[model samples]
Target: MTRVRHWPTLAVLAVALALPHFTRGTQTEFAIEVMITGMFALSLNILIGRLGLISFGHGLFLGVGAYLAGFMLRHLSENLFLLLAAALIVGMLVSALVGAMVLRLGGVGFVMITIAFCQLFYVLVLSTQTWSGGINGIPSIPRPKLWRGTDLPAWLSLDSEFTFYYVALVGLVLLVYGLKRLDASPLGSVFSGIRQNAARMRALGYPVRRFQLIGFVMAGSLAAVAGALHASLFGLVDPSLLFWTTSGEVILMVILGGVGVLYGPLVGAALFLALFHYLGTLTDHWRLVLGIVFVVVVLYAPNGLVPLVTNALGRWRGAKPSARGAAVALPEDAT
Candidate 1:
């Protein structure tokens, strides 16, 4: 029975991880963004869903990570692993400092302060146009090597667009697995408790502020992972990376997919990217169409697509009862 309960989730993951090999063309870029966005949304979920904190400057970590990756590319080798590590370290250090200051605020005050801080950082980056390349963005970032030294057939190169798609997918799988395990742990329970009633938690002797700060730092670190991957994929870092619009977009993605569930972000990201890609290609007013879709989804499916689909599937599965009992009904009368 336990296995039955878990199989569907595992199966969904397997299919998602395998998606890159099955699609081609415009899907390459869209898919890559979805994967990266999935990570971003999941990281945000830890704070918003588990800790009940809203962040409006999450992109600051992402932008910092990306910028660090760009800077490292100049002096260091273009190894994906090294670049990701550097981004994470720098991101965590920056977020640690920023979280200390912002963690003192609550609710709307917290949100606004976060946004202001991110903008401040963004302006500072812009001021250093010589190093950050200003609005033009860093360019020509080398793609990650697939295997250390063995060369592959030209067609099977990881330097291609599809490679980023698969890398993002793999990263999502690992991130979700780790987060799910954490969600089921005792730490997760305490986090949820804090979210439900921070004052009570403090009275009960929990360090609410410290826990929240840790959550923020962890969320920032995970977001940096996504940003590092994005820099690698896009080969650039710019002021736009720290824009509030980017942070808003990630929040929307989380809400559209479902904030609390592990699979919700993946489903939301895929749908979000697909819509953005097709709708943008169809008309210049893509945001208008997207806004309408967002309204409809919020109104009709407030829990997001994952929960909605899971609920529907649960009903369908429940509606189909076993037929074995009916076939053996005669035995009941005999008894």
Candidate 2:
């Protein structure tokens, strides 16, 4: 019965999954960016929303995954699966090591430290001009060959914008659903509890640090997936992946969507990217407009657009609209 009730949602997802194929050029590129950024936001949510950790160094995972993908494509196999696995493993290890150190800090200090770490990575990319091409960045990254170099179907060609869009859509859906399942599991309960009250959980004998580190690693792994896809989709990767603004964008995305809700970031990403795509066409000051919108969302709906809208709709639906004179009151004196 519950499954039956969810059919509408599933139908919506199906339509979204198919919608990108009909578009071409910039529209398709925008759709793919939305999907990939949505995944990145979700990965951030795992840390900020579920585990109560705000990592400003998340670009490390993203940049690393992209560079790793580029390196693998150049030197090793172009098999997408192999590249993704390698990227994820590297990302997890990077996060685990960083988490072990940063998890001990709290508040603004931690944020500063993470930001510093991200800057460190960015500088390294710039310094390795021979390997990473410095500011020029890697370009013309090849798309993965289908079926180990066999002839590809029209639908499976990464060279086709539509094919890549659908691939990213499917990947986002799968990852989002997987995150939802994880959120419902016992481990998720512990993570949530830790988010709400880390001290209380510590008092109750939970290994708080361990749980946090694991959550960090999970988030990093997912972010790496997004990063790898993004690199393949763009057919390029650059130091911009390690930029502080990149991390800031992901943070804004999670905040704009209600964090901890599996689908919220997806919605937020779509809206955000749509604005960047369309509004950027109108003026050179699109960043100003975006900044204003973000400020409004933060001030008025800190829990995010999805939660605010859903709560309003729920209230409206649950309320019984009173007809004229529907309510009567007796005087207290009469009682």
Candidate 3:
């Protein structure tokens, strides 16, 4: 029964794993973008869906990761593991510092403060041209290379798009799995409780602020991972990465997909990017078209595409349960 219930997830995984083989050129590049965007959406959902924190500046962490990775690749080694580890460490520290100041505020105050912080980071990056490369942005960032000193097979090179796709795919899988475990744990339950009723949870003796801060840090770290992946994939890091608009796009992905659903972000990212890619080819006013589509979706499916599809499928299956039951009963009678 458990396996049956997971067929959709398994199917999605199979499709994602096989996507590169079916795609070539721009399609493969787009797939990598989708995966990275999905990672960002998923991380943002931790705050939006799990903790009810509507941040308007989550891109700050994403930028932090991208910049950190870019700086390391330029000055240090292009080790994938080290880049991710550094990104995670720096993301956590930054999130902790910012969260300590902002988590105390809720509602609009929180949103404003988050946006302020993101803008501050953007300004700082622009001002520090010596390190950040200013308005033009850092470019030509290299991809990871395996066995730098040792003689290895040429096919094992991570610089190839094919190899990098799988690396990003695996990283995303591990991230999703980790997040699933976290979401199912007691800490996740506490986050839910805090989201629903912080005062009540506090009355019950839960340290609400601490838990929220921890969640903030965790989400930030994951966002950093996504950012690092994005930077490596694009070989560029720009101030725009930290802009509030980027954060807005991530929020849009979460809401468009379905808040609180584990795989919703992936769905949202795919759909959003597909629309952006296809529509941009047709018109310069793609945003206008996308906005209209978003409005329609919001009106028709407030809960999100994933939940709507799930509910429809449930109803369709449930509608014929009596016949299924009778069929099972007939086999038992024959036995």
Candidate 4:
């Protein structure tokens, strides 16, 4: 029974693992992009779904990680792990500072303040041409080295799309597994409590705001990791990452996938990207089609596609009893 409950996710993971074997290398870029985007969306989910905080500038941290990583790779170190550590540290610091400043504001105020902070960084980057490369962004961004040693390992190289795709894919898997475990942890219970009733949590002596900050910092830091992956994937760090629209896209992904569900954002990112990829070639006004689809999903399937599909399938199956149950129907009579 426990296995039955988990089989869907396991099935999806199996498909993900087997994808590269079945698909062409050309599809590797798309797979990597989906994994990265899914990570970003899920990170934001920690805020919107669990913490009940809607940030409009989550991408600010992403930009920070990307630009910092690009700068480090070009001028300092090529070690990927080192760059990731740097990104994580910088993201935590920046998110903590920003969270401290804006977390006091609730509802719309928090959203507005976040936008302001992101804009500030955006303009700051745009103004510093030598530092951030201004509006043009940091070009020729180098890929990080897997190791800092003289001889490279037998099994690591970011230059190969095949290798990097699996790297990011494995990362996504681990993230989902960790988050699933976290969902069952005491901290997750606290987060769920806070989401349900912040005032009640405060009455119980839980530092609600502090928890929110922790969640914010955690989300932002994870987002920065996603940004680093994005930079590595494209070999460029751009101003578009910090743009408000980028945050909006993640919001869309969460909505499309289903907020509050761990794997929802991933499914959402995949679906959203599918639309963007397929709809894009069909017409220049692809966004219009995408918007319509989004609206349809929101109106008809408010819980997002995952739950909707799952429940619908459950109902269809439930409507028909299995023959095995009938074969054992001595049930009430036997008792």
Give the TM-score comparing model 4 with the true structure, all chains together: 0.92
Candidate 4 lDDT tens digits, 164-261:
87889987887888788877999988887887778788899999889989899999998998898899888899998998888888989988878777
**Per-candidate TM vs. native?**
0.88, 0.91, 0.93, 0.92
- Candidate 2: worst-modelled 10 consecutive residues by lDDT: 326-335
Rank candidates, lDDT, best first: 3, 4, 2, 1
When 2 and 3 are scored with lDDT, the better candidate is 3
lDDT of 2 at 327: 14
Runs of candidate 3 exceeding 4 Å displacement: 150-152, 319-335
lDDT value for model 2: 0.79
Task: Give per-residue CA lDDT, model 3, range 96-199, as digits (tens).
Answer: 99999999888888889999999999999999999999997889998766556446565465667788789889988988998889878999899778777777
lDDT of 3: 0.84
TM-score of 3: 0.93
lDDT per residue, candidate 1, 1-335, as tens digits? 99987898789778866776888875677678778878888898887777887788999988888887777765575667777787778778888999999988887778899999989988888788888887787887766655445466533444776666767777887898889888799888888788777888889998888888888888999988888887877777767989888888888887778767676767777777777778888998988887988999889887777676766676687854222111111111100
TM-score of 2: 0.91
- For model 3, the run of ten residues with the poorest summed lDDT: 326-335
How many pairs collide in each candidate, listed in order?
Answer: 0, 0, 0, 0
Among these predicted structures, which one has the highest TM-score?
3
